[model samples]
Target: MTAADRSARLRGLIAPGLAALVCLAILVGLGVWQLARKGEKEALIARIIERSHAEPPAAPPPFADWDPKADEFRRVRAGGILLHDRETLVHGLAPGEPGRALQGYYVLTPLRREDGTTILINRGFVPTELKDPQSRAAGQVGGETSVTGMLRGSEVRTMFVPESDPARDAWFTREIPAIAAARGLTNVAPYLIEADATPNPGGWPRGGQLRVDLPNNHLQYAFTWFGIAACLVGVFSVFAWRRLHDPMEPGAA
Candidate 1:
């Protein structure tokens, strides 16, 4: 081809070529990010499993010594009087099996320690019908009680999730501060006790609320991003090759 013809062909590719380059960079970057996420997710899952299975301390650590990040999911034993009068229900969805989800609400009740400190215990799941405290009266044991469970931080609600309505006693997430304030509790622990699966008095509020099921599909996500990047490269390569072989009008895209 003549020099002018070659230059025209190269110029014809400028718009589409720059577009493909930008897309390719984004896709490859996403792939790398997902791979890094996979490693971080794996480490987090390991730490959570270890904490969940470890032997608990005699009693929960002092409130002043609490650390949200380092102390989450730590198993501990806490003794206090069950304040059944002040209970909050956080909506929950437990998987009964593959493709089956059992909808319920987690019963959270404040436990009053001898030292006048309070901590909320996620006493666990109860079907919608038994949401009312009177419906599950037997499980609402009064007086002092000891509970073994893992410590957890407050659950955050996303922008898409609805805000907790204290007036109606409706909560979408396990928000500690909101619940404590709504229930008029004082000196409450910063963290919550996710009770272990020890059967309750009437078996209404089941314990063992360990919901640490982190999905590790980052590898698959990385592959998908990389695959799209590869396909883009292949398509651009073929288009550029064809464009280079064929004649193009001057300044055409």
Candidate 2:
């Protein structure tokens, strides 16, 4: 094989080889980004877990004193009568561990605290078959009952979705303010109550099934990206080798 032929083949490989290298670098960069995101997610999960297990804090002043950033997820203890007639059923939630095709609803009612503030309470998830609001008869707690739970800010409405129809007893999202207005509630707390796992009467709206899990698969995603980068490098290497050696055959020369 002539040296000139070999030189020509080497020159032809340079452009494609460089392009492949650039692609490999891009894939590697993406993989690194995903890894960093995974680390961030893990840290966030740790914080949430810590918050969930911490003891409940004292109740803040009122909705007027609520500061979402500083007070979100803050635990508090309060007591009031559950307004059973005004209970709002949040639709689209499924029942049981497997969350199969069975439909269900989240029982939400206003708790009129002693301080004259109304706080929405998510009693618990109930099956759709028990849609009769009266199925769970209103049992008075008699006097003020002490309730402990997490403080969550108001639920926001998503864009492009129709507003919930309370008259029809249908709800898709948890827009607290809207729900409060529909129930003719005044001075409603800025947050809702996620009841603690406590024993309640009749076992209705069984409290304590709040699953606060955050998905953090950033590490796996990062590895996948890195694997793609490695594949890119291998493909480029093969292409480069073929270009450099194919023309070196004696017959071809």
Error of 1 at 229 (Å): 0.6
Across 13-59, the per-residue lDDT of candidate 1 in tens digits comes to 99999999999999999999999999988988898889888888855
Candidate 2 TM-score to native: 0.73
Q: How do the predictions measure up, each by TM-score?
A: 0.90, 0.73
Clashing pairs in 2: none
Q: What C-alpha lDDT values do all the predictions have?
A: 0.88, 0.74
| Residues 1-253 of candidate 2: C-alpha lDDT, one tens digit per residue | 5889888888887888788878888888898899888877776566557777888776675646777666666667778877777888887454466746556777788888877888888777667766776665643244567778777776666795566897886787777888988899998877887877786676666666566676778888888988888888788788777767774543453
Report clashes for each candidate as comma-separated counts. Answer: 1, 0
Q: Scored by Cα lDDT, where does model 2 land?
A: 0.74
